[model samples]
Target: MNAPQTIIGQSPALSAALDHLSALATIDRPVLVIGERGTGKELGAERLHFLSSRWSEQFIKVNCGAITESLLESELFGHEAGAFTGATKRHIGRFERADGGSLFLDELGTMSLRLQEKLLRLIEYGEFERVGGSSTLKVDVRIIAATNADLRGMANNGQFRWDLLDRLTFDVVRLPPLRERPGDIEELAQHFAVRMSSDLGWSLFPGFTDEAMETLKGCRWPGNVRELKNAVERSLFRWGRDDAAVDEVVVDPFANFAGPFGGDSTAEDLADVSDSPERLSTGLPPRRDWPIDFQQCVTEYAKAILLEALEEASQQQKVAAELLGLSYDQLRGLMRKHDLRTRPPRRVSNPRK
Candidate 1:
């Protein structure tokens, strides 16, 4: 058996789900885990198996929906050599391999009615016949199935076997979605960000700014924990500053984006500088009587363009340089000459602490 990692969350909804899972772990009967996508149904199954009496034995897993109907039967029940075309060697099935342990059947609602009948028999009688073999084989295996689909409703529609549903649903554990467990979002986001920072060879994770955390907390994560992790990692990568808190959270990377990298046309890019107040207007007076001081006007214009690019790039110096078509050294020199800084220098937080 593989060592199970901890699931990161302590919300009441999640705590109740874990408590229910622990209660059913010792029963040795089939269990059904129901949850939406990315809600950690597979993790729940792992917890169930590892905590059960069969923890020392094999814990096999198969996705019923991922395989075809014809192949699924042979996969669950071993096929004898020459059982069909290309069946050269005797193939042991998941049930046989999981004997005396647990078998996790994910996407159980997708199993065909015929295969469901065979599975029901195995659960009830603890015996099944391998494909192309006459003798019956028996195994003492516990079943732990999971699905996002509604199995009971499918059974009512004749898409699933009613008996199999009844056998599998001896106990059901439903995981709460991320939005329902709002208190866990910050911790989960920090955990993901810290791991991402480490992968990028950073000594510390700067963490999120107040505005960034508020943006994360206010959003409803439709894709749940997985979505939140992706958003956090993506935002940090785009921010590209390990020494500063992330001030932006890009929940949807594709929202309103155009061109190659969600950028406007090159001409439009230059318009920010062109439309500045310091730019010579079409209604300028005679050259000798012009009211604006040329040197001061030029200095203010450069500062305005620099600040605009910085704001557009979320204060990322490298990206702001790219936006202005300036080299990194050139941008640094400009900022130094203009007495400008993105934000006050702050100490980076030790992620380990």
Candidate 2:
């Protein structure tokens, strides 16, 4: 099997983490990899496994943060037949299945306290019993746990067990955020652009001018690689004013950051009007035809945008208004009308470009 070529990154932090992973690839100890979501902690774990002596064995990935408490235990430790009402058959747990292989647990911080104890026990003794079975089974599986959340903070706050953390802390690997490693942005962009072109039949080299790339770089990507991929896809499909030239792709990633997330739209969710071809939220959208004057509509819309910007800017009103391109007075008036007059200064400094 060939190695994956999709993930292109060579930043300092990534290089250092790779160097450490390369060094510890064959150790088979519990590894704790930490990074923001979409920083590819799972990819790092795979790199470790594939580069190690266990390359020929299985590499299982589990999202500890995703599964619910009850389902999680059953998921980790294969349940015995009739372990609970839904257990119709005996199943092999991830640990047993990955014996002599690797088990990558993504978002380890979300595991419940009871599940954490079970995980600690599994790491300590290399053993675990089925959810309902009394017999303990031993397996030689390497454990690689990761989290985007602050596990250290969780441990400090007593949300996470000190002993459990200690057991999982044999080797620590930290991956830098997309914002931190500026050099890798271009490389990753090219890589993802090509992937987009191949997978979605979009332009191979994105229509983003050098100016556009700078905006991409300036953003604080809350969703990281996953968000970038989505943005690229949307640019190909939904961007432009329906007059995109062959080489002129006008994907305003800055605009994607608009309405609520990246900009100071007065509406907490301008995404209802976002160019995306889907609904922004689950609930019914606000009525477009309010039986009122246009001024009221703009004010109402501005207020919503302002509320959303508060979340992005930590409740700073001035920053929110500026993002909306509104004058301070105008913002204040709208806020007063909406009963959101209280606000801190807008935090926008001069644009980077």
Candidate 3:
């Protein structure tokens, strides 16, 4: 079967993952996909569905983490009219909708024990009852479960059902994080850059310099592919001109860094230090430095911290403030003082003919 276009990578790890998915697609058994966030678990699920015999049927995805426990029950199992306080009509659940096809349960680890029991029944007997209905319904669905959490560990601790794990583990596919596949970084970065450029309707797409590419390949991406995609898009968004070549790709070093101390220094920080006068002729700091502007230095430091927090929170000011241990007002005050407002770069207009 052909691979899905959404899965991008030339590394050996990615190839192995695709092979596993393809091999298991021919069989009709439950599959458990293990990987870190942004590691393309959903893509793996999709590939399995499209490559299987039930490709023509619906491929339904339900995020167990996004839905609350109370709602999850009704979401997975259909509800009869007047079943609960909010139920006004009969509802068809994901299992029914995905009957004779595939169902991708993302963040499966977050599912409650009660829901797990119901899912276990579905997998073991192909039968389930609605939240409020008395009749049992059967679905011929191929289950594909994905999670970043350790399922075996959870089972050992009694948080997850071992029976469910056993059923879903008929075939397992583990995806490697981006850090382990360094060779694919450039390819992925370029892919995201081109895609983002097209999305913005720019006449010309900017090309990354050698230095920028090196910077991208060197940094540790904790959030995996999702983080890398966001960083590339943000860099392109901040690229001021369409005609000029992109000299450097801007990546936030502290994007994944949390806790009291900031993560590692970013490429931008190294550049700042390299250009500072504090460095002597030997590229080393002078033992006795000249007097510096204390206020200016404090302002710059605060602005850098603020920017890092904002990047870590994906530009969410409230979350950024929480990360910095400051109130919303205080965060806003710092942003205004440093003129560190976060806004998308204006599109570069085409020159008149």
Candidate 4:
């Protein structure tokens, strides 16, 4: 029953997407929304529904991945009483509830082949029979399917139905990930900060310092805007100082003084890390090499460790962050600080419908 969130961003990548969505909104056909997690696929779907001629009708949402196949079928198509073991009463499905409106199916790739067929039939003919029900029901429902998965690849592998994919692709709305729209990072951060500030009953929202904004902009938010919003709100809440500018954003709450290796990081852990027997014997110089540049040695050692971890994790930043016991942002900061490149920044062109 929840409405879609407000879409915020002035970046061309986002603006173009919005414009494309607006154009497609009036066309009452199945639309596929593709994007990484937190890229506002649902919001796009909501806009499509609200702007359509069926704006006054229901906007039902279903996460295909969250429910099991059998339950999902029943949920989508409804069921008569005694349809299954738990069917004590007649059930109304999402298709029935979403009659004359929009039905947003999230994680569409997770739907089973059988359900996909039924869905395809419904889309094509605008009619379907509920589970264990003899009566065929017809409903004028617009389909808005969203997924982060590779549906084309899945169809190629026979995991998803090509026919279903074909039907759903009457139009496609590909949302740009947060990394692709870096220009909006500060604006989003400020928006989140203000909302969080108001939640805390503050008179005025103090802004982020230059360092904090840099911290916000440095990392690739794999979870996209949702992750960024969490980081900003958490940093503001932890800062708890409304009067002063937020000088640090805690992108990773788990990061500690022990760097990435985040156990019970005591002083002993710190000393032991630097003064390990292997490090002293192989990595560092003895008293004879006391004149060695200490800072440079430490830098080289840190970089070596980081490189080793990255290699072990196959250069996946999130995996490397996990292996190093650091948050994604912390790992990114360390990589940047050490002048390490995991991979080149990728620019994904948003698809125009």
Candidate 5:
């Protein structure tokens, strides 16, 4: 079994969550972890499983929202040969595989009503038959569910099963969002910076400037901890060096778009542009009485951004790719598409005396 990942942060909110999680770990009932996206609900589930008696057994995970209803049913319950067109052989399901262990059901709120009934059966009695098999299989498995949705509201609205919600919420752990736990921002940012630097082959990690730290702490992270990690890593990649510290940090690229358009537009204005159908449908005004090709305009704008990123990186393709949030191959493909090439800077010749 893999060890539980270290949960970072010392805020009162985080400390309260850990206390509840520690108490939940001692019991053998179903556990439900609720939190916003990127707030680390899955980590809480792992902590529960690893701290329980079933630590040595398999810890199977399934993203309930990522699959269709038909596939989810087959995934949770094994399918027999010729089970609904594509089953070639008898396959065991996650429940059977995680027998005497733990099964982590992520995005539990997205589960269909029908599937919720089947899940409730498993919770009530540890018995389920395969898709096309008659044999009823029994398994002693602990279920640790995680979701960003309000399961109680979902149940009240008739979208989710009330009984399943009641069973799964035997011990509930709600992780606080990053904005609420401001104390963790700097620590998590530094942690991400060090890890990113090591991954990028930097000999020394750059430290965040005081101003940059303040900028990070003030922003409202809608994406929470995951967004913070990405922002830190991105800032490090774009502005950091082995010998120098990061002078500034960009928490959000779109947040600082005031300079290009003569300072008339704020970040909120740019964000609200999508809500205007006139802007999206009409695009730019007609030039020389010719219809504007939005696709071509977008392509040219993207190429310009790529060119600027490459130039800023001193013609280093790898560094430029990181700055533009593209993979090496993706950057190369764009370069080829736009006929962009890197060339050495020309040296100036000296004038004769």
Candidate 6:
């Protein structure tokens, strides 16, 4: 995160993005950040806020998809005491909390039909009412939302509100996934490793050895940067000796990565002249095309966890549990019921060429 608000890389696409971010900072309009999960939508929001005039105020965040439909309204618009079950205390929702500041609505596409209507009005009028209260309260908050889910696509699909979508985005910054920025993976890996080591204790990571780094870059990383971070953490745990150095980082992401694949990771898919004949040798099955094995329920759960992690490492079992304040072991056990796999991962290449 300390690597300057604008991300850095030698690639023309990445450099272009960095240049764009610098210019985009001067505008105060609502900024919508779009990308695959773990691509740092929130980081983009932080950069937007810090660059704006409202830097002096609060930057509140709310994940619309995290809350149940029943509670989402109250969480965003506040609610009078007794608004619903366990509503014993009067609550001020994210909007009011972010009054005079910026409110970051993550996963904004998950907002339900009813909630979307209320949100649209708030954006238009800068006012809203607590769920159980009739008195409309006004806020002077700036809106900055980020989502991996395609809100515009959802709106067109009728799952999201079109009017709300337009209101939420006047300026959108779409970030390419890590696969597009292979040039920056080293920097990102180091950043996440240092941060993870600090929180979990350096002892948690023995290293991301050169071999591990090769494996990591080869991974499809369906979960994106956050998944890469988790992979680094897991790699240390999987292979690290008790006395190993924390910075001796080695990663093999393809050893176990699994999620929906959208590119030509398979050699057959890319028979072009540039295709490399080498494979990552994850020891695991070809995840994207692998057959399902559900003979046991525990295996089922494992498969689900692996899939979830591959697609949304930022919200897979571990991250989801943390967001809900639950123990990871419990969730890990639950993951056993979903038919997850434990094969090795294969690395992928930058597809821009």
Best by lDDT: 4
Pairwise lDDT winner, candidates 4 and 5? 4
Superposed by TM-score, candidate 3 places the C-alpha of residue 302 at a distance from the truth, in angstroms, of 15
Residue-by-residue lDDT tens digits, candidate 6, 205-305: 44565644644555557778778778677655554454664432333334223332212123321222112223211223334544644233324333443
Q: What lDDT would each prediction earn against the true structure?
A: 0.81, 0.69, 0.78, 0.82, 0.79, 0.64
Candidate 3 lDDT trough over 10 residues, lowest sum: 277-286
lDDT of 2 by residue, 1-353 (tens): 45633346778877887888788896868889888888888888988889888888988888887889888788788999988998899988888889998889998888888888888898888888998999989999988889888877999998999998888888898877877777887676666666665666544444455644654555556677766656556555554332342222223345334344334444433333332423222233367765766545655565555676555555654554455554343444445445674455456654211
Candidate 1 lDDT over 13-86, as tens digits, reads 99999999999997889999999988988889989989989899988989898999989999999899999999
Is 1 or 3 the stronger prediction by lDDT? 1
- Alpha carbon lDDT at 125, candidate 1: 98
| Candidate 6, position 37, lDDT | 87
TM-scores across all candidates?
A: 0.72, 0.70, 0.73, 0.77, 0.74, 0.65
After superposition, the stretches of candidate 4 with alpha carbons farther than 4 Å from their true spots are: 1-4, 257-300, 303-353
Candidate 6: Cα lDDT at 285: 35
Which candidate do you rate higher for TM-score, 2 or 6?
A: 2
Query: In model 6, which regions exceed 4 Å deviation?
Result: 1-11, 195-209, 241-353
lDDT preference between candidates 2 and 3, better one: 3
> For residues 158-244, could you state the per-residue lDDT of candidate 4 as single tens digits?
999998999999988899999999999999999999999999998889898876787788778999999999999888889998999
Q: How does model 3 fare in lDDT?
A: 0.78
Q: For residues 91-110, write the lDDT of model 5, one tens digit per residue.
A: 88999999999999999999
Top TM-score hit: 4
Q: How accurate is candidate 1 locally (lDDT)?
A: 0.81
